[model samples]
Each structure stands twice: as C-alpha cells, then as structure tokens.
Target chain A: MTGPLGALRASAVLAIAALATLLQVSLAPHLAWRGVGPDLALLVVVAAGLAWGAHSGLLLGFGAGVVLDLVPPADHLVGRWALALMVVGYVAGRVRADLRPDRRPALGTIVATAAACSFVGTSVFALSGLVLGDATTGVGGLLGVILASVVWDVALAVLLVPVLLRALARLEPEHAR
Target chain B: MTVLDLRPRSPEPPERPGRPGPGGRDDARRPREGRRRPVRLPRPATGRGWGDDREPTPPRSLVVALVLAAASLMALDAAGALAPVRGAVAAVAGPAESAVSAVARPLTAAPDWVRSQGALRDDVARLRSENDALRGRLAAAPYASNRLREYDGLSRLTGRLGYAVVPAHVVGIGPAQSFADTVTLDAGSAAGLRPDLTVVNAQGLVGRVLSVTRSTATVLLVTDADSVVGGRVGTTMDVGTLRGRGEVGPHGLLDLELVDRDATPARDDAVVTWGSQGRGPYVAGVPIGRVTKVVSSVRETAQRAEIEPYVDFGALDLVGVVVPDGTRGDRGVIEADGTLVPGEAR
Candidate 1:
C-alpha cells in the first residue's frame, strides 16, 4: 500500500534503521537496567510510522523486528518482536493520521505515545511467549520487564524520537515543519 | 479503516489561535475517532496541506496480515527452522561491537561514577572482563605453561564433576535481544558443543548451551526467566525444580520447587543439580546454588525456596562445558576424601 519512496529517501531510512539495530546490539546492551534495555529499533519504527503513514509504519516495523529477531544474543523466537513492533508502528501511524495536518504533535504526545506503545510491544511479546508455553517468568516477572522497558523506552524516546522525526521529515517533501 | 481502533482523538481545532479554520462551525461536534474519522476540514492551502479526510487509516486487513505473519514467524522459530539465521549477528559482531563499547565506555562510566557503588560495580565488570581477555591471551601464548594454568583450573573443575570439559570464554552479553538473558560464547560446534550441555564455572552452575553455530554458541544463562534445572536439596536430598528468577535485582535468586508438597525446604540449605536421564542437559552432582529464603504458600500447599547461585552472572568470564562422556582419557579421579584429583597426561 506504500507509494514508492524516492531511492535517496529509502536509503536514508535503511541507514538509520541499520544504525538503530547496531546500537541496539552493541551500545544498548551495556545500558541494560534490570535485564531489559531501551528499544532503539522500536523508537525508530515509531518515528517511521509517525513521519510517513500507517503503511510505511507497518512495513518498517515488520522489517526492523525481523532484524532484531535474527541478531545474535536474541535467544527468543524470531517473529515475536516483529509482531509487537508492527502493532506499535500501526498505532503510531494512526496517531499521525489522526492529527490535523497543520498541527504538529507536542513533545508530550510523542513520549506519551512511546510509553503506551512500549507497554503494548512488551506485553505482546510476553503474551506470545505465554501462548507458546515458553513464558519462563510468572506475572510478577512480566510486570518488572514491562515496567523496566517502559521506563527506558520513555526516557530514550524523549531524546531520540524528536531527532529521528526531523530526519524522517526530511524524507517527505510535502511534510511541513 | 479499522473497526478495532478505539483511541480517542481531540476533535477541537485548538492550535490555530489567530487563524480559525474556514470550516470551524461545521467541523465542531464531529466524533474524532482514530481510524474511522472521515471528515474533511475546509482549509485554504497552497497546494501542500493535507485535509483531515486525506489521513490514511491503515487497512484492518493489513494489520491482520502483519500480525499473522508475526505469529507464523514465531511458529517457525519455535520449530527450529530459524537456527541458521540465529547467530548471524554474532558473526558480524567482531570489531564493530568492540569499538562501540570502547567508545561508549566513558559515556556509560560517567553516570555510574557519580555513584560510588555503581562505579565499583563497573570496575568489577571491567576487571572481570580484563581477566577474561588476559586468559584468552594466555591461552594463545606460545608458552606451554601459560596453557597449563588455564588447563589446571579447568581440569581441577572438571575433576570435581568427573567429566571431560571444553573451556570457553564469554564473548558478549545480550540484553538487547528482547527478554531472554543470555551470553555469547567463543566456543561452538567447532569446540564440540551441542545443545543441552551443562555449563558451569569455578563457583557453580551458570547455565546450559541453548544453541550453537560453527564458532560461537549462545548459552542461556541460569538466571534467564525460563531456565529449569533439577536441583537436590543439600541436606535432605529432595529433588526439586530450580527456576531462574528472571527478575534480577541487586539480589537475584532462583526459585526451587520440590515435587512432594510435604518436602520442607529450609533456609541455608545447599542445592545441587539432581542430574538428567543419560546426563544430557545437566549432570548429576554439580553445585547449583544455596537456598537462602523459603516461601510457602498455605492456600495452594506449595512451598518453594530461593537460591543464591555461587557464580555472579553479571561478571561471567570463563566457563566449562561438561562433555557427558565418562570414558575420556583425561577424566579426573575422585579420591577417598571426595577431593577431585586432575587426571595426568595429554
């Protein structure tokens, strides 16, 4: 459903996504809090959704999630993150679709969306684990990871998303400042 | 438009403080739902501004299709169809990962330095890794004695278990890969590693081999959320399931659940692996951890104990993979005093 993004814009987006995955694998792991780290890739997907539209969001989220699943040190199933982030992307894109074209979103809105979407992404990942009968932790364990992820993602989103949004906005010729 | 969407949007045009929309009077009182809002606001634009109706609501079919795709991926991954693609990240993670860590170490160290304990913990992590690096260098050294010390330490360790062991270094940590807590090891199928091998350190049980590639294997640490090892109570010899707490805090511990509800687990009781059928995943008599807290549920009549593993998973450096073969030439002999004497010769 996506219009063909210009080759330059597509390459830029791919580079950013690769950079996000690189940081997620290397730098982010060192910054883990309580066994969960901030999800830079999820934030990138959220930005892609908001900057473009729902279709763009879905495709990017799905693609980025697959990269995360394939990357080393990820022992969980391959499709779990892909599924969770795709939902996040769609929702974030819907938020973009809902806003009046003239009115830009507040910083509060973006971070709030990130926090809400972080919860969704984490819960979906955990629920999939449960459905597969592979959920190792009980409810209490799930809650800790959920809480930790929300805190970290929210913290990073406030800093990362705005910069990412600007970069993504440059890709869209018609998008206003 | 998605009928499933329930997010509420602000219907009011509150942003244009000076210039109101030309359709302001008509745009009011409209229900602003996320996916179903099809109203077009009459706004004067220089051929660029998108109307509200122009906003694309992703087709529900697309969302459904993507979700189904994700589920299928999970199923395929669960069936072990994605094993070849699993450790591809580690293969590409050589100098790039190391450079990122080295460059960011100061930035990561800054916040922790302000707090004394965090700094100390960082110091320990750094030193532990440095120790691992030194050991790696020592093993690569041309001198035979340098190899002997590592072999001596590992041989003494394997002597206690009476198993041939392959020593490996922890190459990387994985908090970035979602929920599972794991470490990438330098050893893989090349080191004679297969899935379900018992992994241990100088202190106690670390975890088991989850998956392996040609040169690198991922070890699912015992502290992961779903790791289960059969543990024997040190005092009573009652066998119970040792679960990785998964909730690692300043005080992380495993949960031990005995099969017999009547089995009483007391604090300070030692717990050891109860072994496996044919000794595949876990061997018999490896020190797992010590019970420090016992919590009993009166309603369910279930009792479980908390064990503090002897090894600090946070600072893992070196570990041994216990090969189940007992007939190996380098097997350690158990003395009458239960002291393991390292086997002699190459």
Candidate 2:
C-alpha cells in the first residue's frame, strides 16, 4: 500500500479509531447500564483488526486503549486496556481472511467475540487495579462490569460491526484490492 | 492416502527464484544442521508453527516491544510517576469533552423535553390546586399561630429568648442518596450567619450552621447521625440528650436518651431544646419534637424514647438562623467576632 490512496486509508483508519475512542469516553455515561457501557473503543479495535491484519490491529488497539486510559473518569492504571485490547485485536485478526465473502463467521461468533473482549478487558482492569494497591475495587464490582458491559457490547457489535467492515472495505488500498 | 494428503488443498503457485514459497516450508521445518537462523524473522525456528500465508503474523519483536512498553507505562502510572502526563492529557481532553457535550446536549434533552412538557402541565394543575389549599391555610395561619402562641406561652418565651433571627432560603440540597446529611443556605456571614448558630423554621428546630462563607452557609441537619441536642420533655421537664436517628422519612426520628429512669413521660409529650449556656448551637426552649415511644428496662440506667421531629427536614424551603439581637436590630452593634453588643449596628 503506497501513495495518496494509502495515505487516505491510513487517515481514515486513524480518524475512525480516534473518534470511536472519544465517543466511548464522552457518551458512555449517558448510555450507562448499571455503571457500565459498551466499550465502543474495543469494538473499533476489533473491527480494525478483523478488516486488516495483525500489524494494523495491534497498532489501532494500542492507540485507542491508551486514549481511553488517559480520558477523564478513567481512574485505573494506564496500559491495562492497551495490553488486553492489543491481544483481542491480534486474536480477532487471526480469524481466516481466506474465506469467501459469503463464508464469513456467523453472527454468533461475532457476539461471542464481543462478550470475550468485554470479559478480558474487565479482568485486566481489575487485576491491574489490585496490583496497584486499590484494595476496595473488589471482584464483585468487576463481575458486574463484565455482566453489564458484555450484554451491551454484544448488542452494539450486532449493529456496528457490519457497517464498520463496509467502511473499511471502502477504504482498502489499491494494492490490497 | 494420509489424512494430511486427503485434506482438500488450494492450488499453489510456483515460488519466485530468490523468494521462498508462501508456505515457507523450510521456515516451518527446523533450520538445516549447520545453517544460521534468518535475520528476517525475530524468533528461532521453534516459533509457533505456521499461520496461513494469506493472513500475516504480526512481527513478534514489535509485539513484544509494544507490550513491554505498555507494561512499563502501567507500572509507572501505578507508582504515580505519570501524574503530570495524565494531567496534560486531561487538560487537552476536557475541552474536547465539552465540545462533545455541546453537540450531544440537544439530543439528550429532546426526549426529556418532550416528556417534561406533559409533566409540566400536570405540575401546573397540581400546583394550582395546592395554591388554593395553601390560600385557605394562609387565611387560617395567623389565627392558629396566635392561638398557639397564647396557648403555649410561645411569644412570652421567645421575647425572653433575646436571639436575633435571620431568614434564609434553602437554595440547594445535597444528594439524598449520599450519607452526609447537609443542605446549602443562601444566607452566609454577610447575613450574620456563623458556624454553631441554630437554624429553625415555624414548625421547629432544623439544625445548626456547620460552616459559613461570604454568600453561602452549609447547614448540618438535625437528622444527621452525628447530631445531638439537649431536650426537655414538656410539663414533666425530663431533660435528655436528643440524638438524631438518621431515619429515612420526611420527618426523621430522634432518639431521646439519658432520661431519668423514674421520669415516665407519656407518648406525645412535647420536647424542646434545653438551651446552651452562651446561646450557642441550640437556644433554650425551641420545640424539637413529640415523644413517639418510650423504651424502658429495669436493667437500663436511663430510659430512651423515639421523638418525631415537627419540622420536615427533607422538605425544607425557608428557614431562619439564630443570631445575636445586636445583628438583628439597628440599635445594637455587632462585634468583630460577630457577637452582638449593646451599641448600635451599622
């Protein structure tokens, strides 16, 4: 991938990732489900990973995760999501790209992936908080977060993933075609 | 045929002269006995076997480096080493969040506005009905209070009480869901408000001023768990410590403890503030509540009872703070410490 088209693709990916991360931070409170909201940032990373390959997935995941850590009301230690989302992105990217367009994984798979991402993301956050000497953030709260966020994320992914995949396809570079 | 051979296979194209085949069979198999490891791949030949050539594996070295960097950042953040960095990020993100809020505000408000219009009409009708009821109450108020004052000798007592009362409006309420029982009053030091001053309404004792700023004062409600007032039972004058129960109700309960075990004050007995010596946090003879129940035991040294406060702490709107008479009248002067003296006040 090179030249002006490649530049446009890169910009589009970055813009989408940045906008999604910001929206997750800003609008999540209003859409809260018992103190948790769908991690739209994680969804964006998974979409980027599934559309592109591992290298692009890891990059976008790290960038969005770091932005999420820095945002206000984010009281946890930085890089927790960076690590978790990076792994999620890498794993999601591993799904066979050789399949025919019509032979892609079913909706169940996407929903499962969303739930898994929510679980992994929350576990990392809680474990990191424990290591950081935050004794009060107990496992019960983490479990609640996982339960609430997974349902919300799965719902969001159902609506968001296909649109994101289409947008990514539109931005595919000439050589990638 | 072997199972591997029986598996359906996609056709493979011939490899370029120098470039290896897409499968990189040699890469999957161990390096030849004497050959050195290739510089292109970061890992040794024992790396996790083979991924599909079509789906690129992220460089292990890059992934390791990125993960290590992130871990280091987490450690630094946990150790509070990244405080300044976080502050800088927040500084940039705050305005961005504000802009997002501006855009989302209308969208969020639209549904609320539509719902509230119907609610507003209902509220208006309800308030109109309440206004008529209140008008009737107002017509009867002067006569009732006058009769009560005469009946209870309240005016005679209040005249002797000598405290200046400053009227204040309740402007805000602390979150009801929270544990801290407090309210914000519009009156402050400028209005002769001070910490430890008593706050009350027509009904009875409200609370004491906890802190006072130039324009606002925080009043700790009598219903707070920590609040305690000296109270005397009506007629019997059985003095006891009136402690707040912090109950959940419009008029929270108070527990009057340390009463003389022999003093059997009947239910519905009125209780009033026993007054501080220097006209302190509680002034003498302000009605506190009525005895709801009395709990007594032979083994217990002192009797206890629940008193239902006359003032509805949850529904406070207007209240008065007790100050010195000097602050209340022009003829009396206020001292540097806010104590009212005999001289004329400015």
Candidate 3:
C-alpha cells in the first residue's frame, strides 16, 4: 500500500509541475503591468520545495528552470535561472520542517516562500544586467521590479495556494487507504 | 491424555553426538533468512517520514514565483542588458503566441460582427444626410464668385507652366516624433520621384522631397524646422527666407525673413517662390501663403513675417510632384530645334 501510494504522489507532483510550466509560458504575458510580468516559475519552485524534502525540491527546481531557460526570448546565459532556482528550492525545503500543519501556518509558509523567491529572482536579474554592461539597470528600476513581483506573488499565494494544497493533501496515500 | 498417547509418535531422530544432521542445517539457514539485513542507505532516518502527515506544497505558490521571475527578467532585459536573451525568447515564444492567437481569433470576431451590423445602418443614414448637405452647399458656392476667380488664376498658371505633374498619395502625417513636421509619401523612385522634387497641391507649394526609397519617400514640409524656402512678397519683388516653425495643428506657420532690412511686409500680402538662377527647387511665381504678422525687433538684422500656408496639409489626399522641364535634357534639344529659322538651315 505504501509503495503504490508513494508512486502515485510522485506522478501527481510531476504532472502539476508540468502544468505550472505551461501556464507560466502561455498566460503570464497578458497580465503584465506597465510591461512588467509576474514570474510563475519561481512560485512553482518555492511550492515544490515546501511540499517535498530538500533533495526532491532541488531536482524539481533545476528541471523546471532548465525548461524555462529553453523557452522564449533567450536573453540571459542559460544556467543563470537554474542556479537561482536551485538555491530558492533548497531554502524552501529547509523551512518546511519549521512550518506548522494548520491552515494559517501553511498560508504563512507560502507567503514567506514567495517573498524569498521574488527577492532572489530579482537579484539574479540585476546581477545579470550588471555583468552584461546594461546601463539602464539602475537602482530605481530594480526596486520597482522587486516590489511588483512581491506584490503579484503574494496575491497569487493568497488566492490559489490554499486550493492547490487541499487538492494535494487529498491525493496522499494514507488518506486514500 | 489417553487420545494423545494412542497417536504413534514417530521415533525422534537420535541426537547426533558430535556432528550436526541435515535437519540442523535447515534450522540454521531459517534464522539467517528470517533475520533480513537492513539496506545501508546514506540517510536512513530521512526515509522514516515517507508516509507522514505533512501536506504537499501548493502548486500555485511556485507558479506565482515563476511568473514573477519571468516577468521581472523580461522587463529587465527589455529595458536593460539582456537583449540577446530577449530576442531568443521572443523567437521561441512566437509559435506559442501564434497558437494562442489562432484560438482567440474566433472570440475576438464576435465584437466586430456586432459592431458591423450597427455601423451599416448608421452609414446609409449618414450618406443620405451628407448628400442633402452637399447639394445645399453647391447652390451657395456659386455666390462666392470672387473666390472662384482666384482658383481660376491658379489653374491657368498650372496649365501654362508646362510642369510635369506626377500625382502622389499621402501615406503618412506629421508629428512622427522622430522626424517632426515631416510627412511620408507613397510615391517614390518607382514613381519617378527624386530628392529635392517640389511637392504641391491645388492650393500652393507644400514642400520638397527629402529622401526616397523604392516604394516610399519622406517629404520635408515647408513648416519643418529644417526647411528654408526662398520666397517673395507678392508683386513687390521683396525677397525673403521662408523658414518653418514646426506645425500648429492643421496649419503650419512659416517665418519669412526679408533679405533687405528696409523691406516692409504688409499683412495679407501674397507670398510666392523667389526663384534662384535655376537652383531653386520650386518654380518662380508659385503662391506659398499669405502674411499674417510682421515681427520686427531693434536688435534683429531683418524683419520677420508669419505666413499662413495656402494648402490644407491635413486634408491633402493627392499632390503633384513637379518634374522641371529642363531636367530630361531631350526637351531642351526639342525646344532649340523648334526655335530655328527655316530658310537659314540650308
């Protein structure tokens, strides 16, 4: 019973991850504010890390990050996102043990995870900008991006994370048996 | 107890004195097999909570994070240093965008279909109303005979000037932001257009061709900051420099600076091209506009007058590109031959 349930959980997680990638690429552009769009991939990485342990979280983050690097508007060096997401996933996984099993704790975990992911992602972009000799990456624009991403991510967390967490909990084998 | 005794107990095998029997060997193997060795994994304790009560992390949080990151990256790259990455992403995203567009096409058509039905009925009523208004205006227009006379003078001048007129369409308007106060024309090299060709409408001189491509050309309107035209005030033969002061809505104002400091410019004086020694792009005696104001100052070298152009540039649908007669060279030979005395040829 345990073995079969574990396999089902893994497959379910993978499917959700794939779906998240698809949505990030296809739907995120339309929601841009002043030409700034939200980052769905970062949200997915943070969630994966919180759900699974550190090792699985790192693997998931790396895989999704690679797919994103391959997808549109190839502007940056390919491995930049991979490295950034790996760190984010690892951090989220480490924090999982500290979170309580109640509803409020789950919400708090998601909010915190989103904030951290946003900060890391923005910093990576800023560093890449500096490395590439782009003069427009001023302090003001960087701040604006960070603020916008955090607000957008937090809103998404509040609205969508609860429903997703409930669905995942339902899929657990112990509950099913 | 009596029933148990009646059951014959097979004689127990005599215990071996020194060496173990086959049954002892089987008994020895059973304990080893039953006590299975635990697999020596690197982190054995980590697997203990495999079926624990911890909930799976919400996918939405990760999705939100990814979206935020992607958007930030795109914005940064768009305004910052990741131009090459932006291009590559745009290339890969193109097909996905097209697919989405294809799916959304039908959804977008519904609004247009509804709007078209409403517009068709309104258009028919508008046409009927416009026809009635135009008929009334036509009847009233004949009463303004003096204005018609002025138009007749312009038509007669065009006919007698022998200027090769190539009709062109206006493909663009001014305030292009890049080339302020300039317009793009549909006619270009393919239409026999060349740089410095004089462009005009029925009213008067418009501007000159600045640049030309195979299918299009940019016209530097007389009202552009960079444009300077050699113009004269009416029959006074007062020469001046006509400079553009950008555009003011539909009408562009020209600053006419008198060549002679003492030359007095009267309001409503007709401004015409003061042709140079075959160097002026526009022909001599073509009307430009009317003087609106005279600006004279103590420190200024020459008095300046503001001229309101005769052409309604905003409504200009068709224009004439003046191809000077002598430009073709063959016309000059034909003219010289036509002027020869018949008896002197022998």
lDDT of 2 by residue, A1-177 (tens): 421224666567767766777677777666776668778888887777666656667766776778778877677788877887787677666652433222334677667766776677667666766776653657787777778888888899999876787677666532243
Off by over 4 Å in 3: A1-15, A102-108, A128-136, B1-346
lDDT of each: 0.75, 0.71, 0.64
Candidate 2: pairs in clash: B332-B345, B333-B343
Alpha-carbon error at A64 in model 3, in Å? 1.2
Chain B TM-score of predicted candidate 1 relative to the true chain B: 0.51
Residues A52-73 of candidate 3: C-alpha lDDT, one tens digit per residue:
5445465566656655665664
Q: Considering summed lDDT, which 10 consecutive residues are worst modelled in model 3 chain A?
A: A97-106
Error of 3 at B260 (Å): 71
- The candidate that wins on lDDT is 1
lDDT over C-alpha atoms for residue B150 of model 2: 36
Give the poorly placed runs of model 2, Cα more than 4 Å off: A1-11, A96-106, A134-136, A175-177, B1-54, B110-129, B138-346
Question: Quick one: best TM-score, which candidate?
Answer: 2
Query: Rank order by TM-score, top first?
Result: 2, 1, 3
Name the Cα RMSD for model 3: 23.4
